[model samples]
Target: MSSSDIFLGETIGTAILILLGGGVCAAVTLKASKARNAGWLAITFGWGFAVLTAVYTSAPLSGAHLNPAVTLALAIKDNGIEWSDVPTYFGGQLLGAMIGAALVWIAYYGQFHAHLTDKEIVGGPGAQATKVKAVEAQEKGAGPVLGIFSTGPEIRVAWQNVATEVIGTIVLVLAVLTQGLNAAGDGLGILGGLVTALVVVGIGLSLGGPTGYAINPARDLGPRIVHALLPLPNKGGSDWGYAWVPVIGPLLGAAIAAGIYNVAFV
Candidate 1:
């Protein structure tokens, strides 16, 4: 395929991915009014399926990178991809993410506003305890804290999140490279799709608890950028403090995976 076709495919494929993947997040979190809180399993499987779809659609033309970290890893491994194309791929991924995020925002505009009012109060420990009491009182007769999403140390530890992303990406790239080598006959045609689903499912099951398994740099950064740019009521979309980890962690993981795969497996 020509570079132009590859670029277009990557752009469109990534956009669809973010739209479906990120859209699911918005539906579950921001669209609580719609009773659309997709639980952990939903998120995990949704992303797995999204990856499968994206790879199947774009692998023929663009290698289905859809992530800057993946592109960087491939370039480092092959050394044949022109340096000039690196920027193009990254640009397409980011642009696609932004576009996909905008669509998500538009789709969930009403839900965003509805969930904004369900804020958790914060203060000193005593104040927090009191706030919890107040919330409980207000929510009397409602079953225990159902469907309320809260960020806590166990779930949001920075180091843990970064580590999980790194490991997840490493496993993802290793799987891709391995499948690329051994695929046979019609199986070769489906290898990309299968690997895409498997990697995401593995990450979701193994590493998702810490960082939500944002193993793709473009996947995290693009949606976050859109979250900031889009006017969603009370949506703190751009959590800048944690953003760099997803980008840097995945790149580091991919590089390490490539090196290890080459030295040990290849």
Candidate 2:
């Protein structure tokens, strides 16, 4: 694929991935939505479907390396792609993730407002509008709706969070690395998409509890950046402190996976 195709394919595919994935979170979390509290099963399956659609749509153009870790692992595996193309893939994935997140905001604008201010209802009688809530202020990371944009840990153990991200990413990147039925660049056909999607669902079901399974750096960071920038009310912190966990952990896991693939699968 040409640089332009790589750029555009990853951009569009990652965008779609985040749009549907994040859209599910928004639908489930935000008040007054039809899918409110649809539960974790819905989220895991929604993300799987999102992966299927995005990968299938963009595979012909760029092999649908929608996740930065996937791109890195594929590049490391030397899947007939040049090292020079890695940066292009990363750029497209990050840009696409941000765009997808913004689109989710637009799609759920009203729902976001209602959810954020639901408790404060109208900001009228005895509202604490002047001062931020103590819980919001004291808690340094993750706000009311931050989950819609990025992952956060349930228990907040640094080592545990990093380990979870690393393990999940290892499984994800390894799947792509070991998948030999299709040409690496093809991600060929819907079968490839189906396998990847099912793997993602499996990972989410088995490994998502700790850190929400942010196995992809662009998927987590780009949307988290959007969360920080958007004008959503009472949106709380963007959790910049924890952001490095997702990014570094996934990259590290990808590297380990690449090393393993070279040693065992090659």
Candidate 3:
């Protein structure tokens, strides 16, 4: 694929991914939304559909490597795309993710206001327990709405958080690599995209609890940056300190998956 095609495809695809994916979080978390309290199952399936939609739409152009880890894995595995195109893919994905996140905020502007500005909604009567338990969460650094944009751990142990992200990403990248290495370079065929979407849902259900299953770096960091930047009243901190786990862990996992594919599957 040409550089323009890769950039445009990745940009559009990842934006859609986060829009719908983050939309689900907003719908479930933000008050005044019809789907509020719809819970975790809804989130997993929402993201699955997000992947499926983004992939099918963008596959012809960029092979739908919407996630940076997928791009990194394909690069390391020497998938059909030129290694030089990796930066283009990364740039597109990050920009797209940020766009998507901002869109989510726009789409849910009222809900965000209702949730963020209201102390009752922000912390509620159960605020103390939540702050005590999830010390690295909304009360400390990551705001309550931060989860709508990025991932965070239930437990704040550094190694454990990193390990959870790594393991989840390993599952995700391994599945993508196993779906038949391809010419578009990311190996996501039409069927591959559907299967990968389901695989994402599975990873969420099985492994999302510990660290929220941020198997993609762009998916996490770009949105987190937006969360930090957007002018939301009483939105709290963006949890910059815990940000590296999602980015580094997924990259490491992708690299490891690439090594496995190269050493054993290739």
Candidate 4:
């Protein structure tokens, strides 16, 4: 595919991916939505379908590869995606992710307001906004609004969170490299995309609790940036301090997967 095709395809695909994926989060998290409190099963399945849709739609054009880590792993695996083309993929994915996240905010605008202002929302059940206020008084950061847009640790242990991301990403990239059967440039065929989507669901169900399973760098960072920038009432801090974990961990996992593929699969 041409550079333009790669860029546009990834941009469009990743946008759709994040639109549906982030949309699911909004539906489940935001108060007053029909899907409110729908729980984690819906989210995992929503993400799986999102991946299935995006991958098939973009495969013919840019070979999908919506995740930067996926692109890096494919390049490392000698999958015909050149180092020179990496920037195109990264640019498209990040741009698309931001757009998708913004769209999620727009779609759930009222719900977001309601959720943020609700008596008990931020610190989980039975915890009031006043409690969050006290925490914010003592803590330097605002109550985290980025959870709607990005991932975070349940326990706040840096090493554990990073390991969760790395291990999850390794599962994701290794599945893509080995299980996806399409011959296109790091892209899956229809069946392979479906299979890969199921793998994503499985990962979410099994491994998502710790760090919310941010197996893709762009999936976390792009939306996190949007979460930081978008103006909303009491949207809270973006937690820039913890942002590097998702990015670095996923890249490390991708590299490890690529090395393993080269050593064992090749």
Candidate 3 residue-wise lDDT at 221: 97
lDDT of 2 by residue, 150-176 (tens): 998878788888988999999988887
lDDT of each residue in 1-266, candidate 3, tens digit only: 78999999999999999999999999999878999999999999999999999998898888899988988888888544568988999999999999999999999999999887664555556576654544545555877789999988888899988888888888888888887345444548877888899999999999999888999999999999999999998787898999999999999999998898888887
TM-score of each: 0.80, 0.92, 0.93, 0.93
Please write out the lDDT profile of model 4 over residues 1-266, one tens digit for every residue: 89999899999999999999999988887778999889999999999999999999898888889999899898898655789999999999999999989999999989888887776655556776657664663263434456778888777899999999889989998898888857664677777798889999999999999989989999999999998889887677777878898999999999999899889988
Tens-place lDDT digits, model 1, residues 199-254: 78877888777767777888878776665565544343244656777788888898
Candidate 2 or 1, higher TM-score: 2
- RMSD list, candidates in order: 6.4, 3.0, 2.1, 2.6
Write out the backbone clash pairs for model 3: 138-142
Residue 199, model 2, lDDT:
91
- The reply for model 2, stretches above 4 Å from the true place, is 78-80, 120-138, 184-189
**Ranked by lDDT, top first:** 3, 4, 2, 1
lDDT of 2 at 98: 98
Report the number of the highest-TM-score candidate: 3
Query: Of 1 and 4, which scores higher on TM-score?
Result: 4
Q: After superposition, how far is residue 73 of candidate 2 from its true place, in Å?
A: 0.7
**After TM-score superposition, what is the CA distance of residue 206 in candidate 1 from its true location, in Å?**
1.2
